[model samples]
Target: MSIQRELIETLQLNLIKHKVILLFGARQTGKTTLLKKLLTSDDDVLWLNGDESDVRLMLQNQTSAGLRAFIGAKKTVIIDEAQRIEDIGLTIKLIHDNYPEIKIIATGSSAFELKNKTNEPLTGRKLEFKLFQFSTKELVNHHGLLNENRLLQHRMIFGYYPDIVNNLGDETELLKNLADSYLFKDILMLDGIKKPEKLIKLLQALAFQVGSQVSYNEIGTLVGLDSKTIEKYVDLLEQSFVIFKLNSFSRNLRNELKFSRKIYFYDNGIRNAVINNFSPLAIRQDTGMLWENYLVSERMKRNHYDKNYCNSFFWRTKAQQEVDYLEEKNGKLFAYEFKWNSKKNAKITKTFTSNYPEAEINIITPENYLDFVL
Candidate 1:
């Protein structure tokens, strides 16, 4: 069964909306596949792969006339893995300026590579979109809610990476390959990452610490690196889309834990692969952390697809009062706590509730998690 991706129409609508479309995602999130689905035999397109040295050589240091001659009469040009080609932003800018009739699409696995290269050159000339791993809504649409609900534990363990979703019975090996291969390809290509083992060590430490407040100093000590290097490594990992940070929300309370962050992997499979743990949830001790990570990450996909404009955080106080997730939109605060066990009694902390009295709060469990994510 081919699962219909949600970003296809959005990308289709925006293709001609701007002179250039920049599609960014982590490796194997299906950017290339999604764009292929958007093309038809009726459209004229020229595809280029930046991974090829010849393609990189041909596109570099091109003038307007050179770009024009190279592109000829192509209506649409797609450069897959575009970040490999140096000066690609200038090349696209030249094409956009000279051939206003042509539409250019560029797909890059790493955002830092593409965004840093294009930000200045393609400022107003481009529309940007991020493609993520298979989302919960897409999965629900594919197999129906009843079946999807049954797969919740499986989803939490294996995650929703497109390839993982499509290729069953081979998920563990595939995730390990993805983690070992594409997960850090872009980061390791840089000059600063001389000791690749340290990067691996850092990720292993992070995998074990998922859903907890991350301390650079402690992580640095555990990984045998300084805090500054750890910060830089963490920044690179975030840019690579392997992980994300949710900052602590603070406002009126003096006890709020400010300047602290909790990091979650973009996909639970990647986190599990990092730690080399694919143990089922039944025998696992980290189910709560897994549930929290899955919920928060899926919520991110939901908001992105829904075009939700809201700020999200994990709120906590110095005295241990906390909320698992918090979102603010249109001057209204919504708070939630995640409980894996539906029978447990849960409530908002008096400290958090007293300060943000206007904030809405609820507890989410296996019985009602679908409402929170889907």
Candidate 2:
């Protein structure tokens, strides 16, 4: 892979002026791969990892002078897995303040750990980039972006993780390994939840209910836990990048369906893996779930990497009128419905049209979506 152009270009754009660049994502999203690509030109780059004992010792020295000495006179210094080091926030702050010219890049797996340590101290001094798995656009550079038919079919089956794309082995086994080894490990270690079994159970239930209103009380009842604990565990999963929550889009008090949010997996492959459902495109029962997840993931990448900041939501009413995604940008709201078929079945509701007369409503199908998203 000749390095996704977006990350390379983003590194070049942010590295020169910013004192600290923080890169974070789920495990195996290729943080190390992207950082190493950025290191190609500089011979003076210093790399330190908290996984190493000596680096942890140097970080915890409590003296700014020792930390400065460790940073040395390199033009660029990278701390991989910065969350493993104690007082990493103040240590990076020391280098950033004293050596204004030196550039620093740090990588972490979880946002909760990384942001808690770095966000407050490095305010206005840092640029954050999230390295997600291969986007439809990134995949386009290599294999060319998928067409409507193939994209919809493959997305539900194989998902967008980097290793899964490159592995070319049994996808079923690959997803299983990812869920068992990577996703579960982070949850157990970070949240101190002893039962990996319960997490798997919760996720499996979620897999069946994608794009539908999720009832935490019902989920707790099914999984044999209280609703509050279910919410906490779901938050933990979201923070770890295991799943993403889409809140209901509500502007009018009359028709808005409050207190009901839809959840989608960050990676459909992991979702399938947890549920142990590797049925081929022709035989799958959850094709709708797959389609919804693929669209949301693609849109998310466009929003993040392309710097298209917009408020996104799903719209529905008490009477069950719905739109899959609602985007608000530039004082205009845009409603979109994702359908696998190009045949149009979208109907704009009178209440929605009356509420936001300025907003545009359009159906995004396999044919015309690339022009909008890519």
Candidate 3:
């Protein structure tokens, strides 16, 4: 069954106005599926896959006339894996500048390649959107709140990837294949990495350290690589959308842990796959970490879909006082503490409240997390 994506309407509206629309996400996140849904039978569409040698050659033509000749009279042009094509940014720029009548949609799984190629050339000519693993809102919208509540633990363990969400059998096997295949595809395909095993080792170290500050030096020691390599691999992981990093929040307090950052996986299933663990929450020692990661990732998806502008961070001081999530938006601070156990009391740090008396603090648990994320 196909679920409607939140970005479909926005994308349809953008197509009418923007010369080019770039949809970015990790592999197997249903970008192509969404694009197919957006296209109708009457629409004059030219679909091209950048992975095809001939398609890349046709699009790589630098001249506007060359691109125009290839596009012909197509009203809408869709390119899958656009980042794989050489000079794609310049090619898209040429198409938009010369053939303003043609609407373009480009999908890419690798931000490192696409952003570097597209940023400057298509600066004013493009609208960009990020598609994440299915969000809580999407699931609830399609399956109802009652079903969502029943499947919460399954989501936390197997994650909300489109394939895994739609399939009912062997979630652990599916996630393991996804982790080994698509999850590391971008990193393995990229150049300058002599030892790919180091990347896997780094990810394994990070999988265990979710919800906590990560030290590059410590990870390097665990992975048997140097700090510089660890940092590069971590950056690649973030760029590939396998994980995200949250820096500490500080307002110049000397005791604030400003330099450290926490790492969280984009999906819990991928995280568990990294460590080869899929035991139920009750039997797992890392349930708290899973809960924290799930809430943060869902919040991120909500913010993206809603187009909410905010800066996010984890707050902690040298004294070890902490808040799991901190969001700065509209000149105000909203702090959140994540609790898997509803019995736990939510408390703001004395240091945080004293320094920023205007900020608001709240607790996010399973009982009320939908309000915050959805």
Which one wins on TM-score? Answer: 1
> Which of 2 and 3 is the better model by TM-score?
3
Query: Higher TM-score: candidate 1 or 3?
Result: 1
Q: Tens digit of lDDT per residue, candidate 1, span 1-374?
A: 57789999898788767569999888899887787789874348888999899999999999999888887777889999898899999999999988888889999877878888999999999888888999999989998999999989988999989889888899999999998788656568854787899999999999888878889999999999999999988887887788989999988567889899999999999999988889999999999999999999999999998899999999988887889999999999999999998888889888888888999988999999889888
lDDT of 2 at 185: 74
TM-score of each: 0.97, 0.92, 0.96
After superposing all C-alphas onto the true structure, candidate 2 shows an RMSD in angstroms of: 2.3
TM-score quality measure for candidate 3? 0.96
Instruction: For residue 230, give model 2's deviation from the true position in Å.
Output: 2.1
Put the candidates in TM-score order, highest first.
1, 3, 2
- Candidate closer to the true structure by TM-score (higher is better), 1 or 2: 1
Task: Report the error of model 3 at residue 362, Å.
Answer: 0.7
lDDT of 3: 0.89
